[model samples]
Target: MNQIVLTTLNARYIHAAFGLRYIFANLAELQAQTVVREFTIHETALNIAEKILAEQPKIVGISVYIWNVSEVTELVGVLKQISPELVIVLGGPEVSHPPDLPAVCELADYVVTGAGEKSFYDLCTQLLQRQTPLNRMIEGVSVPLPQLASPYQYYDAEDIQNRICYVEASRGCPFKCEFCLSALDKTAKPFELGAFLDEMDNLYQKGARNFKFIDRTFNLKVKTSVAILEFFLARMDDELYLHFEVIPDNLPDDLKEVLKRFPDNRLQFEIGVQTFDPEIQELISRRQDNQKTIENLRWLREHTGAHLHTDLIFGLPGDTLENFAESFDQLVALNPQEIQLGILKRLRGAPINRHTDEYQLRYNPVPPYNILSTRDISFSDMQRVNRFARYWDMIGNSGRFKITLPTILGDRPFERFLTLSDALFNASGSTWKIALKRLFELVYEVMVGTLLVDSEQSQTVLREDFLRSELKGRLAFEETKPLTKQKVGKGIANKRQKMHQ
Candidate 1:
């Protein structure tokens, strides 16, 4: 029986829990007695409890996050009722701070906060030896970069083959963007590069084709960034795919040169252009060179083969719907592969809370804690933006409406799209589960009837998009054409990849 179990509810099965593996790897002498169990939110609390109980764990450590916190809270409550003697421990960003803990924290027997690897292991050691700590909250000890063991070796054959192989060459972010939990970090610190690469090589040799780096500022150190890229270049196969989150403004010549060498769709950069307004940037202590960011985005699109996935957050303290729309329009013009439209959430202990009063920020008070309303944007407008984001995912970002999107968006991208988003929701009474064929019809109807576009133009363009989408069925505007098969595997890793598959 496993004496110590490290577990977490992943958002999806495809995501192997990277943090749980790190803690498991560092369990020291307790490694033999410990096991790592992962579950997803989709599973019922009773089912998760049954599997967890089967292990007969003495101390159960659960890694909580914003995505799975509510379900985890319910799971923890279930565990407490069934196994009162079980020592429940909670550790993760969700439970880490706010001296004011949530219901989950109160239910947990012990809580370890911040850089929890070493601290958790030590707690297990103490508990297993029949000596429990006096206080429930334990301050996590930060191990030096060189001293911390590489977590890559923990990935098994199944994980490497099926899930996103998450690897981090470093920890922390230098920027103090108030909305992000990473703003609490003092500075960015790199692992010993040689050691880190050695572990990556080990992973690569074992058939890990997909490597998604968890570094906050990957391109910050040009030398380090180039070395990692060069390592992948040495083992360049058509299957080798890498994902990095790079600082939008900091693409040096050395990094770009290496980046350009990679084949198209082989590299994906998640660029965070949270806001284009300088006032919001300053208000949030975000230091983005907006001019440089635009230049780099345009350059990446023009020069490199990298798939650019950019982000824009709607509800910052001072941001208005009009300015947010302007930002959306600006980025739409650049034409990234995907635009992750986000609503700002109040993360516990995040410095963004400083503006809660001034901005009249009201959050959902639930798991994600997404802003319900802000001083600048009304609740009804926020709901409209929410619908806009949802329908945009189905239509705009799906890349299925390439031919018709430009016409629908026209000169004012945000306003025009907002109009369409409103009409789609009003017509369909949903932003979800609309079949591809049905979506095409909805867009066509909205274009011709609501937006008052030319019937012939709408039908022609919508039918072209429909044909390109390669659906099986025919629409009213369609003439029959054979559909082309979609290809997906081994290279690109986005949430949208499933549709093509």
Candidate 2:
């Protein structure tokens, strides 16, 4: 029986918890007595507690996050009630900030805040050795990159075969964007390149193909980025997919040349252009050269085969509806593979809280704590934009209506789409539960019946776009050739399928 069990309720089973694995790998002498167990938020807290108790673990560590805090809170309560002697340790982002500790911490025997790899190992050693552990809450010391043990070697067979294995070549962020939790970090730090690559080589040899890097700035160091890219380039195949969150404005010529070498759909870049407004950027201490960022984005779209997923945040302090629309239209014009329109969230320890009074920012006071209203944007306007974001995801980002999307969103893409968003909300009273065929019909009705576009032309364009993505469906417009004969690229088809699922 395992005397120590490291467990956490992950948002999903497919997401392998990297934090727990870090602690497990660094357990040193206590490694043999320890085990890691992962469960999803869907499981009942009682059931999760029961499963952990079944292992008869004397010391249990639970990694907590905003998404799983409620369930984890209940699970911790149940564990305390059933097994009074069980030493419960809580770690991760949810418990890292002091002023915003959730109610779950009171039930926990110990809470390890911040980077818990080394601290967690030390705590486990003390508890497992029948020694009294110090303090109820311990602040984790940030272990140096080269000094800490790598967590990749502990990824089990099932993780390598099925899950999206997360590999971080670095930790921390250098830029302090007030809205982000990473803003608290002093500076970005990279792991030793040779050692990190060796770990990656081992994972690749073990049949792990899908790798998602958790580095905040993957392309910061140009030469290091090139080496990592070259490593994957030599082993490039159909199944090899790598994802990175890169600094949009920092893509130099060397990095751009290396990035262009990756095949279509093999590399995905999540560039965070949170806002295009210069005034707001200054207020948030987000130093982004808009021109350079836009230029890099254009080059990435035009020159590289990489799928671009760009982000935009609404409801910033000084952001007006008019300014946000300009940003939206600009992003649409860039023609990224996907645009993630996110509402500003007031994170627990984020410095963005400082702007709350000045901006009249009101949040839901719940998990995710999305901005309900700001000084410039009213509650009703925020609701409309929320619907606009969802509808855009359905029509624009789905890649279903390629040719017809521009037709639907006329000269002023944002204003036109906002009008359509209003029409959609007024008609359905809800944004979700809209099926593919129904959505097609809605678009046809809006464009033809309301917007007064030529009915015949609209129908033909919509039908073509519909046929491009869907395999089986009869359009309201016309009869088309069966998709069975169409030769769509394997990568594009797979992406669409995954998105819909």
Candidate 3:
């Protein structure tokens, strides 16, 4: 039997890791023995290497991403040293959308671009048939094959309940946000809704309670997006939860009505605003109506029970620290369920790379490749923003902030935590875990000192433990919840203050 091995880091363990089920399921018909293995680079790379070596597969395929690329590269180097003759194929979002990706050309023998379902199968067949190198085997983009199956599958319902199942109803993004790779690859080809619904049903039956749509812009197509929503609406019985990425300004009245039918906690939408500064938006080629976005957000809050997660990007071209702060304050005023503060990622295929000189942008040399600062923003300000990103991830989105921090502070003022944590971590030179612990401690102290709540630390600790247990893999979701009765009381008080003020 022909044997093929596919391995990578698990998506559930890391929030940034996207699912590879579609690739595995589509290539299932290649008439070969296949094994899929998952492990964290931080967990055990060498042990995973040993296990895969023991299998002695003919071909080894590994999915690469920004977070795990270094680990995967190192693992591949070790794997090749041991086996010497294994055919290594690399593919995924990271490799697919690079202008001149070094890892693909030097590390992996073959790099499959775009959708790998058909390309992977074709390459496997050719290799088995005595083709030495599959260099000319770039599928999907180069050759238009109708038979190319989309690789996506829902996991066992019971297994999926504990994990986040990522599904994609479409491919490609329709925007030209210069800083984003998806913007360059705009098209937004949607799949059949009935077929997608059937796939979802299979997953639902298997025990999935949480689903995240990986589509670039789910709301770009009203009819298709609405159909999927309606299908889920018909089946939603409080047991299932779905998450989507939506364009805030493009939200339709009809979809808002559909969302209203579902329980507030059952559905969530992550809207990427990037920036509210019109000049900054124009610089990045991101077309957005600042006023419309705010109005649409208010409409969703009033009409739908769905949880709202809004995003803001720091360090865009022509944006200073003051501009970013102002944009952040405005977004916070909207009172989203979650505020994801992201720094700019200078991706390879992104159009913004072409305008580096025009913008006079200098980015970091690390994994994230964030902008250092430009004429509009200073280097010191960018460093401060870096700290802001770290704290926001931990306290704002991590779900632990609401539990300890007094909600007496308005959304805009609560953001002071980001600046505070930035200053503290810079002084201590501490790791994120250590920084997070300190931030939580300080937040508690502030709450108690300010009389935000009465003595209820003991009750809050138990509640936190419960949340940690209930949502083991979903740290972001778990940490964002109000942990104590005191905190909950403070939240109510703060809401009343907002209304009255």
Model 2 lDDT-worst window of ten: 492-501
TM-score against truth, every candidate? 0.96, 0.95, 0.82
Q: lDDT tens digits, residues 1-501, model 1?
A: 999989999999999999999998888889999999999999999999999999999999999999999999999999999999999999999888858567899899999998888999889989989996988999899998888766789899999999999999889999999999899999999988998899999999999999999999999899999999999999988678899999999988888888888876778899999999999999999999998999999999989778888999999999898999989999999988778899998788899999999999999989789998999899999999999998888777777887788899889899988999889999999888998898899899898887888988998777777766656767866656444454333345454532222
Please give the CA lDDT of all the candidate structures. Answer: 0.88, 0.86, 0.67
**In candidate 2, what are the lDDT values of residues 1-501, reduced to their tens digit?**
998999999888889999888888878878888888899999998888888999999999999898888889889999999999999999999899986888889999999999898898888778767788768889998777777888899888999888989999888999989999999999988889999999999999999998999999999888998999999999987789898999989988888888888877788889999889999999999989899999999999899878788999999889889999889888888888788999998777888889999999999777767889998899999999999999989988887877788898778888888888888888778899988887887888888866778988898778777666654767756566344433345672246523321
Which digits, one per residue and each the tens of the lDDT, describe model 3 over residues 186-243? 4777776777788788777777667789898899888888888898877777467788
Task: Using TM-score, give the best candidate's number.
Answer: 1
Considering TM-score, which of the candidate structures 1 and 2 is the better prediction for this target? 1
Better lDDT candidate (1, 2): 1
Off by over 4 Å in 3: 11-19, 97-99, 134-154, 157-159, 398-419, 426-431, 435-441, 444-501
Stretches of candidate 2 off by over 4 Å are 477-487, 497-501
How much lDDT does candidate 1 score? 0.88
* Candidate 2 TM-score over all chains jointly: 0.95
Identify the leading candidate in terms of lDDT. 1
Please estimate how well model 2 matches the true structure, expressed as its whole-model Cα lDDT.
Answer: 0.86
Better of 1 and 3 by TM-score: 1
